[model samples]
Target: MPFIPHTDDDIAAMLQTIGAPSIEALFDEIPAALRSGERDEIPPALSEQAITRLMRLRAQGDEQPSCFIGAGAYDHYIPAAVWQIATRGEYYSAYTPYQAEASQGTLQVLYEFQSMMTALTALDASNTSLYDGATALAEALLMAVRANRRCKSKRVLIPRALHPFYRRTVRTIVEPQGLELIEVDFDAASGQTPVERCAALAGDQGLAAVVINQPNFFGVLEAVDALTDWAHEQGALAVAVVNPLALALLTPPGEWGAAGADIACGEAQPFGMPLSSGGPYAGFLCSKQALVRQMPGRIVGRTLDADGKPGFTLTLQAREQHIRRSKATSNICTNQGLMVTAATIHLALLGTEGLEQVARTCHANTARLCDQLCALPGVERAFSGAVFHEQALRLPQAPNTVLERLASEADLLGGCALGEHYPELDDMLLVCATEQRTEEEMQRYATALATILNAA
Candidate 1:
C-alpha cells in the first residue's frame, strides 16, 4: 500500500533472506521514543488547473526587477536561440564524461568551448571549466606556486583593488596550504595597482606569483602589460584575473607583457549566463601550453580511434576523482557543464564579430550612464582610470543606506556598495549598465540617486 517497489511476496522473500520478520522488526534496535510519531503534514493533491493558478499567484508575489548591479555579474542580453538550442534533449545534461563513447557529444561541446576560450585568451590551452570565479582563481594561484620551481618564496602578490570576494576565496584556499597571499597596493588616485609597488616586491627573494585584475574591483583598468612584465622580471608568474567580455576591447592577458601573463582566468557568467542570485556560473582558466599539465579541472581533446575517425575524449583530468588526492592538481571534481553548454551555444551564435559588438555596446552604455550619473550634484567618479562596463562612483553618504533607499522606495536594484568589502571606500558604490540597460533605465537610476542626494 505504501508504494514500495517490491510486492508482498517479494518483500517477504527479502525479509526472510535478511533474517527479519517484518519491515517494523528491522527497526527493533532503535529507540521508539526518538522516532517521528506523526505523519508529515502534507496537503491533498490539487487539480491541475488549480495547481497552475496557485503557482501563477505565487510567482506574482516576486517583483522581478531590471538589474543594474554589476560588481562581478553583468546583466547582458541573452539571445533567444542561446538557450533554445542549448536545451535540446541531447545537449541538456549535468553529467561529466566518464564514458568516452557515450559522452562524445558532451565531450565535443566541451572541447569546442575550450577552443573558443583559448582563442579568446590568446593562450595555448584551456581546461574544460571550474566551479566559479573564486575557486578558479584559487586553483590558478596554486598552479603558479606549483609551477615556480626556481622561486623559493610561495608568496603571491594580490592587488588590494582585486575583487574582495575573490581575494577572500584565494586566501581561504591558499593559506591553508601554507602559501602566502601578499596584498599589493593600488594607486590611490587612479584605483590601478601600481607597477612600481610590484617591481619593489621583486627585490624580495622567493616571490612566486602576482595576481593582476584587469578592470579591477573598482572597475578601473589596471596597467596590465607593465604589471605582467614586473612579475616576470621578479621571476614570478603573473596570474591575470580578467572579465571575458572586456577582452574584446582591451589587450588579452596572454598578450599583456613582453613575455605575457603566465595564467589567465576569470568569471564566464557574462557569456550568456544569467546572474541567478550570483550564479550557478562557470570559471575559466587558460595557460600557455607549457603549463597545460598544471592546469586544473578536465580537458577534452580531439582524437582518432583504430578506424581513424575523429572523436572526443577526456584528457588531462587532473583531479582527486581521476588521480590520488596528493597528486591531483586540484581537488575540484566537477564542472559547471550546463552553464558551459549555455555559454558555448551563446558564443557560437554570437561568433567573434557579434561578441565584439556586444562588448562594445556594454562599454558604450556604461560610459553614457557614467556621464549622466556623475553629472549629479553630489556624485563623482571615484577613480581616474578608464573602465569597460563598470565603475566605482563617489556618493554623498554611505552607499548601503542610499542603495537600500533606492531599492525599496523606488522598486530599483541599485549597484553594489563598497563599504563592507572596502571600508576605505565607504562612500563609494560600484555602478554599471550593460547593453541590456536602455537610456531610459539609465536616466531613471540617475534620477533616483539624484533625488536621494537632494533629500540628504
Candidate 2:
C-alpha cells in the first residue's frame, strides 16, 4: 500500500471521532518536553525527481573504496538477478508469515533458506534466520545450555580465537541468564585453539558446550574434527561458529568429527548482501534434528493441505512471540526476513557447484594476495596454518598507521588492524581477498603497501 498522510481535515475528523480536541490531545499523556516541538524538525518534502537528484549528489560525494576488510562480513559478487527477484512487491514488503494460508510465498522462501543452510552446514535442520552472526551464536549458546540434558553446568567454553565481537555479544546475551563463558586461549604459533587446551578443562567441570570456529578469527583453520570429538568426549555439545562461504570448500560442521558438531551458525552475508557501510546482514543457525525444538526462530515445513496439495507453513517457532514466554527457547521475535530472502534467491541462482567455485576462487585470490604482500620487506604471515581466505600478517610499522597511509595515499581500504583487539599482535593486520578482488587490485594494494613501507 502507498503511504497516505493525513491532511488537516482528515486529522480533525479523526480527532473528533475519538473525542480528541486535536492530534496533540491524543498524545497528552506523553510529557510536553518529549513531544516533537516544531514542524521545522522534519526536512522539507521534495518531488520524486528532486529527491533522486539529491540522493545521487550525496552518493557521488561518498568514496567507493575497494574493500579488503572481511572480519565477519565479506565482499562477494552479488548477481543482478538476486535482488531483482527478492525485491519484487510481495517479497520486499512481507514480514513474518503469521498467516500461513495467505503467506505461502514468504513461507516458502524461508523454507528454501532453511533447506540451503542445512545443506551448506550438513546439519539436520535450520531456523528461518536471526539478527546477525554475533547474535545468532549467542542464541546458539543459550540453546546449547538448554538442549544438553546430560551436562548440568551452564558453563560454555569459548575460544579466544573466535571473533572478539562475537565473544562479547555472547557474554552480553547469556551472562545474565546464569551462563558462564570460559575463555580458551588460542595457540600463538598456529592461531588456532588447540584441542589440548580444551582437554585440560575436560574433567568434572561439566561443560554445557564448546565453541569451534573453523577458519577462526585470524582466518587460521582450526582442528575441527579433533575439537568436535573432544567436545563430545567431554559430553558437551560442540557449537561450531563457521563461515558459510568457507563451508563450500571446507568440511561442513555436521561432518566435523566421528559424531559431528551439534550446532552450526554463522554470518550468511556473502551469499548476496552487500557491505552497505557495515551491515544489514543476516545470520544462519542450523542444528541436529534432536535439537530442533531448542533452536530459536521459526522453521518452515512443506505439507499437504486439506486439498492434498503441497503447502508451506511455519512448522516450529521457539521464540517467545510464538510460544509461552516461560517455555520459550529464545526471546528473538522475528528473523531478518528481507536479507534471508535475498540470500535464498542468491543460493538458488548460484547452485552448489557455482558456490564451491566462488569459495575456491576466493581462497586462491587470498593466497596470492598474501604471497604478494609478504614478499615486501618486513612483512610476514602472523600465524602459520591453513586458511580459507583471510590471513593475518605482521608488518614492521604500526598497522593503523600503515592502513591510514594506504587509504589516504593509495585510495585502498587495506585491511583491519588487529592491535586494538589483540594487543599482543600490535603490529599485525588482518586482510582478506574475496572472489570480487582481482589480480590488478591485489597488485595495486601490494605496490601501495611496499611504497608506504619504503618511504618509512
Candidate 3:
C-alpha cells in the first residue's frame, strides 16, 4: 500500500491558510505552457527485477571500444584495498568534523594526507585538499596577489603551454577582481616557455606572479628553475601546476631556488583516483610556512590528547569564514574528503619504492610510444623537450578526421587533437601512455594510426 503523508483535508487546510483555494492554485504564477501541460506518454514503472534486467542490457549496449585518451584525466590502476577501506560505512558517510574533540579518526587521516603532500612537494606545509587542480591554481594566484599586499603589480604571467581549462579557470577567477593576466608564448620547437622572453615583460613594478606547468600541456618539461629565478628577481611569485606522479621522478618545485616557489598547485588525479568522467578528483596546494595564514582550505594537524596520547585536530582555521567574516582568507568550507581519503590510502599502499615503480613504468611506456610514432612516415615529434608520459605529434593529415576515422572504422579511442583548442596546431595530436597500457595495445594503436594516415 502507498503511504500518503497528507490527506485531502490536510492539504486543503494548508492551502487555505496561504489564501489559496486549492493546491493547483499555488502554482498559478507559472505560465500555463510551462506547467506539465501534457503528461509523459510512457509506460508504468517496472518491478525491481524487471528494472535490474533492463539496466544491465542498457549498460551492455553503451560499452565502447578500448580507450587510449588522457589529456588531464587518466586511466590508472587502483588497488582493491583502496575501495575495500574507502567503502566502510563510517568513511563513506563521514561529514566535516565540526568538533575536533570527538573526531580523532577523520582528523588524523586528513593530517596524514597533508603531511604526505608536504613531503612530496618538499614544501613547508600543505592544506587538506581543494576541488581540483584548476581551482587550486586559481587560489594560488589569489594568494600571490594577497601576499604581495595587493600592490599595483597585479599582473600574472601564464605560459601559453599551460592546460587550456586551467588557464581559463584562472582568468575567470581573477578578471573580476581587477587582476591582469598576460600569456607568454612558448617556443614551438622546444615546447618550453622562454624565460628571457617572459623577463622582458616584467617591467618595473606590476608583475604579481608567473604561472607555468611542469611537463606542460604538450607534455614537455619547462625550464622551471630559470623561470622561477627571473620571476623572483622582479619581485613576483612563481607558481607551478604540477603532476603529482612526475614529482616522484623529478626535483620538487620547492628546491628550484632560494626564493624558490611561493606556491605549488596541481591535480592529484593520477594518485589512485578514478577518472570518473572528468572529476570528483582532488587538488593539492602547498606553500612556505610564511604564507600559511593566507592559504585557502582547512588544514588538519596533529596534537596531544588530555591523556598525553597522540591525537589530531583542525588547526589554523581562524582564517576561515566561520572565524573571520569578510576578512577570511577563503570561503572554501568543506573539501573532497572521500577522494582525499582514497589518495591517502593509495599513497600508503604504494610507499616510496612502489610509487617510483609506477612512475618508471609510465615513463617507459611513453618513451616506447613516442619512438614508434616518430618512426611512422607522416608522424614527427612536435617538440624536443624531455617529457614524462604524454607527447604531441604533428601529423600530415587533419588530426580531427584521423581521430574520427580511428574511432569509427578502427574501433579505437584516439588522442586529443590540438586544433580544438589551439588553431595553430591543426594537425597535432596529443597522446598519453600510462602503466595500464600493454605493449600489444601500443602496437595496435601504431598500426591503426599508420594505416589511417597512409589512406589520407
Candidate 4:
C-alpha cells in the first residue's frame, strides 16, 4: 500500500471539518515575510526508470574491486540472512528504547549485543555503543580518567603504532579537556609499541590512562601483557583499543595482565559490516565493573515486572544527552542501532568455533601470502614481530603510485599506503586478507605486486 495518507477528496473533507480554508491557510499564523517561494533549483522529477539508470551509472563507476585494503574499515562477508532479518519491520523500524515498555525489542537486541561484546572483550560490562572506534577510544580514555580518582593529571599514553585516524580522533575529542596524549614511538625493528619508551613517558606524569592496540596498525601483535603491567606499575589505567575479530584469536584486553585492562574499545565493523566507502560502523566500549558508571552510551538491563514475566529495559538513564548536562557520562548523540543489529545476528550465527575458524583462516591466508610475496624481489615484511591477518610490507616503488596502478590497471585495491600518515614508512603498504579472500585472490595480489615491483 502507498504510504500517502489520504486522497484529495478525503483531504478536502478533513480540511473543511477542521475549519481551515486550505493547508497553506492552516500555517497562516506564521508571517508571510518568512515564507520562501517554490524552488526552481530542484530539477523536475524523473521517471523511476531514469532514476534507476542514473544510479546504476554512478554505481558502476564505484564498483568494488578485489580488495586488500584494511586500514580500519575491513571488507567482510556478511550472511544474507543477517540483513533480511535485521531490516524486518520489528527490528529495523524501532528507534532507541526511551520508553522501556514500548521498546522491548530494541532493548533486547541491544542487551544481546552488549552481552556478546563483553564476552569478546572479557570486560565486566559493555556499553551499547559510542560514535565509532576512534571516538570510542576517546570515551574510554575519558572513563579511565574519571574512574581513576587517585590520578591527579589527565594524561593518556598512546602508542604511535595505533591507527593514525584513531589517534587523530582521540586528540580531537580529548585534547580540549586538558587531557594530554603522549604518543610513545614504536620499536624500529618490530613495529610494536616499545614498552620501555611508554614506561618512561608514564613515569611521574600522574597519567590517567594508557591506550594500546592488540595488533597495532601495522598488524604486529604488541606485548600486551607486559605493557598492561607497565601501565599499572606507573599507576595508570590500561585502556585497550582493539579489533574485535582479532580478539577471537588473540588474548582479550581483560585477560591481558594480572590486573587486566580497566577499559576496552574498538570498531565492531568486521563482525558483519561492509566497507561502504568508510562506514556506518559500530564502536564498542567495554570496561571493568569499577568503571561502568563512567562509561558512555546507554545500557539495557534484563528485568521482570510485577506480572512475573521476564523483560528488558533501559538502564543508567542519566546520560547528558538524555538530560543531566554537566553530570553526563558521555555527550554522544546516538547509537549505531542498525549496525549493532546486524553484528548481533552475525555473532549469533557464527558461534565460537565458527568465529575461531574465520580468524584462523585469515591468519593462515595472510601468512601464506606474506611468505610467498616476500620470496619475490624488492618485497619484504616491514616488521619482524609476529603479525595477525594484516601486515605492512616495504614496497620497491612509491606505495601510493603502485597502489593506484594496481587499482586502475589491475582492478585491485592492493593495500593502504602508510607513508602519508607515518612519513618514516616511506614505501610501506599495509595489506590485509580476511576469510573472504580466496587463495587465488591472494596469489593474484602477490603476482601483480611482484610484476609491478619488477617492472622497468
* Best prediction by lDDT: 2
Q: What's the distance in Å from true for residue 261, model 4?
A: 0.2
Which is the winner by lDDT between candidate 3 and candidate 4?
A: 4
In model 3, which runs have C-alpha deviations exceeding 4 angstroms?
A: 1-64
lDDT (10s digit) by residue, model 3, range 34-65:
87754578776687789999999988887766
Residue 445 of model 2 has an lDDT of 95
TM-score per candidate, chains pooled: 0.90, 0.93, 0.89, 0.96
Task: Spell out the clash pairs found in candidate 3.
Answer: 153-206
Per-residue alpha-carbon lDDT of model 2 for 432-451, expressed as tens digits? 99898988889999999999
Q: Global lDDT of each model?
A: 0.86, 0.90, 0.85, 0.87
Which stretches of model 2 miss by more than 4 angstroms?
5-54
Task: Please give, for residues 1-456, the per-residue lDDT of candidate 4 as tens digits.
Answer: 245789899989999999898888998989989999778998877877899999999999888888888888887788999999889998778778877889888888889999999999899899888778998998888888888888999988999999999999989989888889999999989898888898678657578898889898999999999999988987899999999999888999999989899899999998888788778889999989877788788888899987999999877777646677778887776789888988999999998888898889888877888888889888899999999899999878899988888887778888899999999998898988877888888888877877787783
lDDT of 1 at 146: 91
Q: Backbone clash tally for model 3? A: 1
